[model samples]
Target: MRKLYCLISLLALIAILCTGAYCQSPRTANHQPALAASNDAQRTADAREGQRILMWAGWIIGAFFVACTLYLAVERRRVVASKDAELAGKSQELLIIQEQVNQTNEELMAINANLESIVEERTLKLSKVNCELDMFLYRSSHDLRRPVTTLMGLVEVSKLGFDENTAKYLFSKINDTAVHMDTMLEKFFMINTINHESTEIGEVNFEEILDSVQHSSLVHNYAEQVQFDVVVEPGIRIVADPQLITFILKNLIDNAIVFRCKDGKRQPVIRIEVRPVGNAVGISVHDNGIGIAEANLSEIFTLFYRGSEASKGNGLGLYVVRKAIEKLNGNITVSSRLNEFTCFHITLPPSANVQIQTEAAARPVLITA
Candidate 1:
């Protein structure tokens, strides 16, 4: 547009200069008066023509400038609108990003709070464990040293040259002390083994397992004072760790025997009954024995908790029994009346059924009292 305006201005200036030269020429001044007059008229017409061309050129240039200005204004407005739209879009995106950041911060805060709670819980558990450990150490040391100290005192007394009857009594007391120490050590070892050892799962023959336990008790004279009876569903078998189950049964049976009622005229009876319960097997060791006191029942399973003053127990048998039952995913519950009966009902995992026999001999067998 500028080039076009410049070209029009240059052409208008050339026309004006040509018209002035024609009007002011010296040849025209020397011409006859008629011819000079004629030349003046022609110069006048050419100047008028040049003036009209200049006017048209000015209008054209003005129109061209106006069109360019309007075009530029429209283009600038379009550019501004595009930039505004882009800015608005970017602002929206920034707002979304801010929201996401705020949400992330909230989640982090929640996680931090939960972590604090978890840490507090774990600290309490650790403190409790530490206290229990301290008590265990104190009690275990006392129990362990008592028998040794008694044995040493007895030895010193024997060295003082006692008579034959006194010597015999001292020897018996020393033997009893040694046996007590041995029992305590054996229980301690059993507890350690149960805590550390891992046993495998297998098909367990309850009849065989119960028989073995009964035979062991009999050999140890546990059955001598108590009438033993066993009633089990025939061919009943279970899947569990045999050693662990055996340990649980043996401990319960032994407890029943040891705590039998000595004052009753009738023989103390320990009856074993087994049956199926849902997806599990139930075994109850019911005894007409000196039952546990209600207040002591809850603490019976605690380590080194003794119920009776006459109890020869080191107070680990029930604790070991409970641990062994847990290993097989089983549970034991007790119901008893003081000096009448105590029943330990145990539920074990599902058992395997290998056969179905109906005869009395093949059915659930009862041990003859």
Candidate 2:
């Protein structure tokens, strides 16, 4: 639309120029005859009149063009002012957003600092609590043992003065209760002393440990009726605390017998196998008794955790085993099927032949008299 208007304006200007030139050219050609007389005056007047009309037309056109230009300039300035105002408003908004971002960053930094301080405080408190608990357990268990020992001795003395039948019943009850109390206290003492202790790495014969444990726990009395296979190769010797190793095996064997199947048709079996792992020995106690549920296997080593279907126990056997194994820098794993079988794999470092000989030489003499 603007292009068509400009083109028409240009064409009108060209036509006016051509008309002015043509009129001037004719006047110039007839100049001498016209200017020598009165007729010259008339021609001059006519020329002045044409000049006046042309000047008036030029003034009107120039004024119209100036008015249009002024109106366009005013409109352009208004548009520019409006756009500048909008830009200023956006700039203010950006400043507010920047301030908000800075505030959020400051809050985040403060939160992180607070969290770090909280973690440090909790860690120190936890360490102190653990130390206090260990000290308490050690002192408490030791203090309780004196009274329990005195009571057990008195009971034995009282048994000798009474009739045989009455004394037997009373003595049995007293022994059982005292033994249970001692075991509970001993467990606390064990937990307190077991951690961070240096392990005595010696040649631990699994067969010997099993035999001693069976004799002591009376698991062998039930073993006669059970068809269990103990497959322990003689050369397998693990590096661990010998007494602790015996304790662990005794607990495992006791658990096996405690949950033995009572089915008359299918005979119960408990297989104890020791195999050589790299730089260690793997002793597994596999029992075809009342197997543990899948969910209970992980919790079996937790202190005082007894499963729903488990037989009555203090639930410290596996916990004790784990503590002892950890002291020896070993690990234990478990796999089980419900009512089918359960296997516990304990891996411990193997004692070298030189260390075994050294241990043998360090034995003390016993006075048998």
Candidate 3:
């Protein structure tokens, strides 16, 4: 492209030089006869006419060059205008992109704010649920006392079959049993209203809790004939809720006695043990009277589930037990064989920092988020 421009400039310079040389050429001067001079004058007039023609030709050529330069200038201006229009279009597109980005940022901020609001709302809902659960526990505890008192009276009346001396001992045991039930009911309510912030954890004597449960159940006539053999290590102190722990042990012992099969041929036997497992305490209740079927195992702790043609219960006892264990942040597992044996292993944390295990396949873990 540079070479083309240089060639065009060189051609214009050559044309100008040729035109100057033609304009500068001098005319000839010499002596002449009258007729010759006249002829010379005519020749001179003809040469002058030729020079005027050349001058006109030069003007026409100069005009042509001017016209070409103007054409080139107009074309260059058009090119510049087209480039400016293209740049303006690109600038408009960039503005649109910037506006879109700003709008997207605003929307994102709005979404983030909504997410925060949802979190705050959920926290308040959880607080409300905890409050309601505490209220339910108080109501249930108040309601349970009426029926339990009547049951204690009935047990007293049932003692008529025995002698007076035996009756007196039985009444003492019965009264103690009622006291124990009352205590367990109090613990049951505590379990239902468990809060990490509200619970007090200290040295819990597991052996004593178990002994009280056994003695209490005997007073209630639930374990009159069955001999309980507990093999728990004495002086074993676990950091847990004493009331809730006692309630858990009571329910387990009660369930063992209640689910005993009337295998007309054999007597009821139940074995209980509390042992340590990898820094955690495991309390197991084993019964030889009656065992549950595998199919009914998973359904045992559902809200009001019951086994078919097997045992009878209020259906909430085990559910309450499960909730109590959860209050302690512990785990419970059960394995049973029909008409043979059943074992329940309750594993508790050594202290307050117990890992709570979820057992949806076994029983529901009752806890708040």
> In terms of lDDT, which candidate is strongest?
1
Best by TM-score: 1
Candidate 1 accuracy as lDDT: 0.77
Instruction: Give the local distance difference test score of model 3.
Output: 0.69
User: What are the per-residue Cα lDDT tens digits for candidate 3 across 8-50?
Assistant: 6677667767765765566565455556667667677767876
The runs of at least 3 residues in candidate 1 whose Cα sits more than 4 Å from the true structure, single-residue gaps closed, are 1-128, 215-219, 350-363
Q: TM-score for model 3?
A: 0.48
Clashes of each: 0, 0, 0
TM-score of 1: 0.63
Give the per-residue lDDT of model 2 (tens digit) for 67-141: 667766787788899999999999999999999999999999999999999999999979866875675557555
Candidate 2 matches the true fold with a TM-score of 0.50
* Two-way TM-score contest, 1 vs 2, winner: 1
Candidate 1 or 3, higher lDDT? 1
- Tell me the TM-score of each prediction against the true structure: 0.63, 0.50, 0.48
lDDT for model 2 comes to 0.70
- Of the two candidates 2 and 3, the one with more favorable TM-score, higher being better, is 2
By lDDT rank, best first, the candidates go: 1, 2, 3
lDDT of every model, 2 decimals: 0.77, 0.70, 0.69
